[model samples]
Target chain A: MTDGDVMRRGDFSNGWKKSFQSLEKWAWRTAVDAAVLLALAAALAAGVNAWKLRGGGSGGLPWAGDWDSYVESKALAAGIGIVTMRELADRVPSAVLDARPRELYRAGHVPGAWPCPAGDVDASLAEHVADLDPAAPVAVYCDGAACADSLEVALELKARGFARVGLYPGGWSEWTANGGAVETGETEAAP
Target chain B: MRRALRIVLLLARLALAGVFLWAAWGKIAAPDAFALAVYRYRILPSWAVNAFALWLPWIEVLAALALLAPGRRWRAAGAALAAGMLAAFTAAYAAALARGLSIACGCFTLRADAAAGGWTTLARNAALFALAAAVFADAFFDRRRRTPSPENP
Candidate 1:
């Protein structure tokens, strides 16, 4: 057959076959390319996140800067003894801040400790903090290590500019453990 | 034709990359939640779930970035890797559906927002698989064009 005849006769079928083959090849190639793109993207994102997290450590996630700052401030306050946990047995005659529910406090508390549940401390600070001499030490304690009530209470106190706020991290458990004085009544001490 | 194919391939790569990057971020953001999702699938052993949670996102991210790189060979390798992951995910989802298990798909979010007992998850995975397939096809076609053989006659 002449080249022209062959080209015409084979044009449709041959071209169709070649096109199909090309398409098949293209589909396979694209699939491979996409797969690689996807893998690399995932790896980079994960690596960056992991690295940031690793660097963060106990400092907290990069997203919550405010939380980290708050934690740091509390730590500093606690470290400087400006905010500290006072042992009920110490009886240093400082302002005793109880960080338990009022009902729990009524059931019992350190004899001189005042009810200052962490939740209410923020709202009632004007009433409670006013009762204590600004210069006098403020001992904040909660239920125990398992409870973060004292930390919350201390944070509030510090925010309110109470220079002498203290967190008794060991709270009621420590008080009872040390055979500290206890009072069980709803007597509201004058602030 | 080559330019058109390249453009289509690039678009596919971007879409796949975006999906993988989002998935990885979601998992990394809530590793515990991802782990829970993995455990719910009941495919892998409980011990492996945590490790998968930790490493899978990185693998996906690496593959996505590699595909976007300038080197053609590296891009081809990346396409293969990504296709493998998509295939694995598709299989896992398919298996879960077959087992009649209601497991959350920890793809775009750590939170189980999608219905686990339905075809939606499977459909999403299938779409991803299709994209990977397209990428693979493009690379293969490009390679074939470059390496012509006497069989063409």
Candidate 2:
């Protein structure tokens, strides 16, 4: 090839190379900016939320019984004992009342748990569980942290003269998540 | 096309930024509450929930800022990131819906708003994702045709 042709080809290639280099440099700048922003946000969030970060799900899942389960303070103050998965597994309560809605209870629940919706806590317990002694222990649960039905049911049970009312704050979600035995289609026997 | 539709693009960018900023505020304020909300989704593994919560809102903040920032580089970067986030959110919401989860959306607020994530959430996020992707594509291709800016890289 002629020197002139070679020089022209080199110029053409250099043009393309320059364009690509410009695009690549722009990309690098954008990436660096994004990285800086992410680092800043991470640092700020980590700094601001350090209190929660240290103990909140940082170590691992909120599993193993102590999963930052947001149990209401009043329930604890009212003498309701918090029941962990370990406790529930070790010693089954005499009455394991599922405080979730009937539909949810039927979907799946802790094996042997009886249907007792939160709204119908008073009447349902009275009607379905009237045969049980008031002094007997009763454990209640609902839909874990997102749910308050368990607390309501526990308080109702407490007022009903159930001396031992254990509150399973983790509820059905925790049970299923931790591979606890699940029962569907309703348990035939009342707890 | 970008030049002709510059006004429309600007408005789209603003709307997405506004949504991101609004969503980020509450989560940033209450990391613990948002963490719990993330847990409720049941889609993310138990371990990643907190870290995901911590990072997501802040990324949202960055994307919003980038969209608002001047310069074509910022615009393209912001749209790309925003599209990715919306895609992720849409997928999470769809998963929750498919799984029959009835938990709070944890979308706009940290107040444990009872408004559940459902088909509506999926649809809205899908729409937002489309907008972001469109904007991103426009920025991406439009840059290819233009001479590089003389500003320092």
Candidate 3:
């Protein structure tokens, strides 16, 4: 090759090297920045969630992932009929039981749900759900699929000779996720 | 003309920032609902859904703030993150649509509605991606223009 050609080749090789270095630098810096931003976000989110928990704003997110699981398998094992959002909307159960804390129920719950938290199912049932006809189709739900309170309530209803017991696996979380209208405040506390 | 282009880019970037803040607000207010929305996407495992919901809004907020940072590096990084999220969302939407799943987009609101997850969402995401690309490209080219070439220097 001519002298000029040799110089051009060297220049081209150098340019390639420089370009590769620039790309490597850009990737490295961007990754570091993204990681740092992610860590900062995680820390901030943790703080906010902790604060929400303290104030009871987050409700009871006892289980994450499969939040709509309704502990479906458990409900099935107990011979409880499954309820989908579609079916719930179509039928609109005669009685809807909110198997969550009174505060969470007050904060935001399925419309027409009567609070019958898991801790005092018997008392809650007697106090809140006693008036409803057990023979009528009743739907039970709680925070989300991860919650077992709905199943507990459903099973309890069956034992109490409730003829029609259906379990809404999706629960409040699913309801909100599906854009269902939520009713806040007390739902006429039992006297 | 260059000044006009710069102004357009600036406004677009700001608009993106506003959208991000708005989206983050809904999610932050209703963490449970957001988590359920994420679960409905069905892309992530149940174990990871809550964590994703908890931290994703924060990431969006930080990225939006970075877009407004004074430094070029921060702005570029922020755009990169935003672009990455949009690309992932675009793909997810496409996949879900392909599978014939009609769910809420959860793009902005925590409350999942039937109206959100239409084919139009893909178009919206594409537009947002273009905005992010413009911001990122501005930072990338600005870097190259400011730095002297090794051979010349």
Candidate 4:
């Protein structure tokens, strides 16, 4: 080949080398940008969730719990201090927390029950009773003795530094059966 | 034909990203409930449930963002990640079905009321998996064509 042709070929090789370098740079930039964006998106989502858990955002039902298995062991462990409807009525525990779903609470709950559904009790409790005195008496119940959610809430409360959490295992069924005062409306606390 | 193929791939990428983002929001909003739903699957170890519940949604958001990011490499990586996720989901669903363990899919909603079991969930995952694979393949081919070609030069 002529010297001119070789020189032209050398230029072409250099051009390809430059192109490859730019391509590598572009790939690296895209990768870093993508990683940053992804991290930002994740952080934002986690922050919002944390805010909701802390009662900063308007509350909504997290979801339903159709797959839950009512275990007898949970019921036994949950019955740490079972309260009767009579006792609950006569004493008027510091807080009456309904562990049923928000729909159930809205349908009808103990007149002053705080709707702390078991589906997302960790968040609901923060939303409903974040400021309640943990040392004070708290009563939790679910749909009925058949429903194990109340026990779950009671256990959660105890774990959260609640000093005197009680389980009313008979739940809504028992309460309504005994002609207890019932209120139906939004699940929020009374004015 | 190439142009049409590119359009279809772009649409597929957007749809996958949208679905992932939507799914991530619900799960992220209710991690505790999601964790419980995961536990019901009885697949992962007990301790892993909470951590998975906490991290999976975030990873999904990340993957979705990566899928729509501007660049073939990012999109391809994202598609591969998405494909991996769908495969994991399909396997979990299959395992649940094989064991006859009736449970919720916990896909879009954390609600346990919507018990998603059986072949339908598996089919849905399979379809999603196919789409992700297509996106990955398309991205791979597109990147190859864009690369410096000796003969073309």
Question: Highest lDDT among the candidates is held by which one?
Answer: 3
Compare the candidates by TM-score and give the number of the best one.
3
Query: Which lDDT tens digits does candidate 1 get at residues B1-153?
Result: 769977988998888888877887777666655665665566765456666666677777777776676655556656677788888988898887887655567777553233353588778788888888777655544454444431331
- Across B49-133, the per-residue lDDT of candidate 3 in tens digits comes to 8888889999999999989887777887888888888888889888878876556788786543334457799889988998998
Query: Model 2, retained fraction of real contacts?
Result: 0.18
lDDT (10s digit) by residue, model 1, range A25-72: 655555665555555655654565567578742211232122223332
lDDT (10s digit) by residue, model 2, range B114-151: 34657787888999998898777656545644534626
Local accuracy of candidate 4 as per-residue lDDT tens digits, A1-191 = 22343354353456656755654564554456546655665576557656775788643223233223434235434444655566567655888888888888898888778888876887877777778888888888887757878887888888888878877755788677767788898645541
Worst lDDT run of 10 residues, candidate 3 chain A, spans A1-10
Evaluation by TM-score, superior candidate among 1 and 4: 4
User: What does DockQ come to for candidate 1?
Assistant: 0.08
* Candidate 4 chain A weakest ten by summed lDDT: A59-68
lDDT of 3: 0.75
Local accuracy of candidate 3 as per-residue lDDT tens digits, A1-191: 22343254344455656755764676677778888998999999888887787885754243354544537656655767666566566645787888888899999887667888876778977776677786688888987777788888889888888888888877888788777878899776332
TM-score (chain B) for model 3? Answer: 0.91
- lDDT scores of the candidates, listed in order: 0.64, 0.73, 0.75, 0.70
Candidate 1 ranges beyond 4 A from true positions: A1-191, B1-3, B112-114, B147-153
Error of 1 at A80 (Å): 52
RMSD, each candidate, Å? 17.6, 12.9, 9.2, 15.0
